[model samples]
Target: MRSEHDPGAFLDRDGVINVDIGYPHRPEDFRFIEGAPEAIRQLNRHGYKVIVVTNQSGVARGLFDEAAVEHFHNHMCAELARHDAFIDAIYMCPYHPDGQVERYRADHPDRKPGPGMILRAQKDYHIDLSRSFMIGDKESDMKAAQAAGVPGYLFKGGNLVNLIELILKQIGRPLER
Candidate 1:
């Protein structure tokens, strides 16, 4: 693994940036967690792109389609911009083996724990995963980061502040007051 001084780190979406509302598909349900926007802003200030990797199994459940998910993401971006934070990209995997439709059936590589989305981002944006960090709220998130060769932070249920301190320590950079 590379040192934390690197700039091109990545992050996950669902529970990292916004509270996971269980396959959130509605714009009204996208709640930004406390300190999340600030944390993202901090990373952005340090030259990190702040990409969002999410696994939307809702697509498989046929609750909401990809278009709806994109709409939700767009709204999220707009809200984040209000806090002077913006995501570099929002990559999602809407496929699930137990989902609906002929096409949605089966495991997808882009799904969390598979690292497909992160890999694609690395290839498309020349990201350095070895030096990057990922913040997530689930074991899948950690697994995905591991598969992508990046360190992961399991954003505990509500330990947003703890995560901030951890990142600051890992980066060996003091947080701005």
Candidate 2:
């Protein structure tokens, strides 16, 4: 079915796909969630354009540089590629409310809960919000999805298989497995 609305879903990077260890900018620091690749592969197989919107306050805090973040993404994409899943686009907000760097400081509209990233994806990809859903581990993901008019799924602590099963059911397609 072609959805004239909500053409794709936006995802969070850290806690959603990888283990959130403050700010993971190194390839060695990257750890994929048990079923993240498969889950994303499922989304791709189902024809969902998986996009990632992330908040990298570490850049503002001087914990890491933008190049490190970009490199991190490149490594991440390579890792996911092994599973035949790739994110459509990745939007990151490196600024923080209080940052060491002048440019990195201050609130930015692209931050989660702000809807900037989601809206940009919508405008760029022509997504239908009501038809797409975001799966994330933070409340900010919920707020962002809500603000962008897309459904949100909070990833509470649980088994990976169960989580995917739940998401499928919530989206109205029970996993055949």
Candidate 3:
């Protein structure tokens, strides 16, 4: 049974929100995909809680630390704020079974294809999963959304605002102020 809680727009960070440049942790490397900010702003105006779910295995691989990831996210947020767009929350998985870091060496449920992050977000935000959807660039992200019982959309790269508009139309969700 679905609750009256608001629907959420779950987004993948890399490839979807920003250009995926391998293990991007530096602020200078952070670049938003075309129309990503406006896409997020559209979601905001449509009454969807924009949430970012990403896998930052770079931390586990020793390429960067969690602090670096946080700093990168902060930079993204700051840039998005300039367009009057904001993400409600962000969940990242730093664990990988083949990680070089001992503490992060594990196949964590929060990792994509596991759905732990989305499930946790659902609980924390009281989101109605039935009405929620995820946009990602990988099949693992689709699997995670399926596992969490939410619809998923695959982004193959292009203008994100166009994708968001199509998704809204497909879902029959009217744009609101």
Best model per lDDT: 3
Going through the candidates in order, what is the number of backbone clashes in each? 0, 4, 0
lDDT scores in order: 0.79, 0.82, 0.93
Model 3: per-residue lDDT, tens digit, 63-92?
A: 999999999999999999999999999999
- The whole-model C-alpha lDDT of candidate 1 against the native structure comes to 0.79
Candidate with the greatest TM-score versus the true structure: 3
Kindly provide the TM-score of model 1 when superposed on the true structure, using C-alpha atoms.
0.89
TM-scores, one per candidate: 0.89, 0.90, 0.96
Error of 2 at 90 (Å): 0.7
| Alpha-carbon shift of residue 8 in model 3 (angstroms) | 0.6
Q: Point out the worst 10-residue segment of candidate 3 by lDDT.
A: 168-177
Whose lDDT is higher: candidate 1's or candidate 3's? Answer: 3
Tens-digit lDDT string for candidate 2 (1-177): 655553576889888899898889999999998888888887776666688999999999999899999999999999999988888899899989899988899899988889899899888887776667787898999999889888888887554446766766677542222
